[model samples]
Target: MVRDRLSWMRFCGLGIADTVPDANTLWDFREALIKADALDALFNELDRAINQAGFIPRAGQIVDASLIAAPRQRNSD
Candidate 1:
């Protein structure tokens, strides 16, 4: 019999196949992700376009960006 090399942890009847770190470590990771502002990414790109992108990247910028809701569309029609 070949044993699978993956480790499993149970969370509310669901199997999470990974090594278990401490709860405090998990909390720290959660905090880190919470602080990772994804909205800041677009602002950062716009900032670079205005400030650090020199000329080439600015010229190549997309003028139109359409915002689409993800959940309502689900897999997109």
Candidate 2:
């Protein structure tokens, strides 16, 4: 989904032509977090912050973003 979703790619700070990490890289990163015993803490803090911000977590929601064409500005040197 991230590969095809502009919103997801933007949220991940990846441009359209950027290379997304494969499953093995993600798994290795997760394993490193697990080894460091930070996964639960990371998620707990994220959940806490989300709830504090009054965001209700939902699943299977499709998010989209649109790009608006803007006029190019010219500056005098």
Candidate 3:
């Protein structure tokens, strides 16, 4: 679905000439963040901003628990 969608780059605020990164690029970036121990801090900052914006309900909001499947990788073997 992502491969078929050209709007992701625009949604990410990238210029039309900029290429959207593929799954491997996203994974490597995530790995780098984890290696630097920055992932938790990033999440905390996002959560803090959301809370400050009153997005969290006082009674607690029910979040969708569905899991999104990742794209399959081809085996070289």
- Pairs clashing in candidate 3? none
How much RMSD separates candidate 1 from the native structure? Answer: 16.5
Give stretches of model 1 more than 4 Å off.
Answer: 1-19, 38-77
Report the candidate with higher TM-score, 2 versus 3: 2
Number of the top candidate by lDDT?
A: 2
- Ranked by TM-score from best down, the candidates are 2, 3, 1
Which is superior by TM-score, 1 or 2? 2
Model 2 poorest ten-residue lDDT run: 59-68
Report the C-alpha lDDT of model 2 over 7-38, residue by residue, as the tens digit: 99998899999999887888999999999999
Query: CA lDDT, every prediction?
Result: 0.56, 0.92, 0.80
Residue 44, candidate 1: alpha-carbon lDDT? 72
Model 1, 1-77: lDDT tens digits are 01232333332233444445667876786677568864467667878776764654445667778987776645766
* Model 3, C-alpha of 33: deviation from truth (Å): 0.6
- Pairing residues by index, what is the TM-score of model 2? 0.63
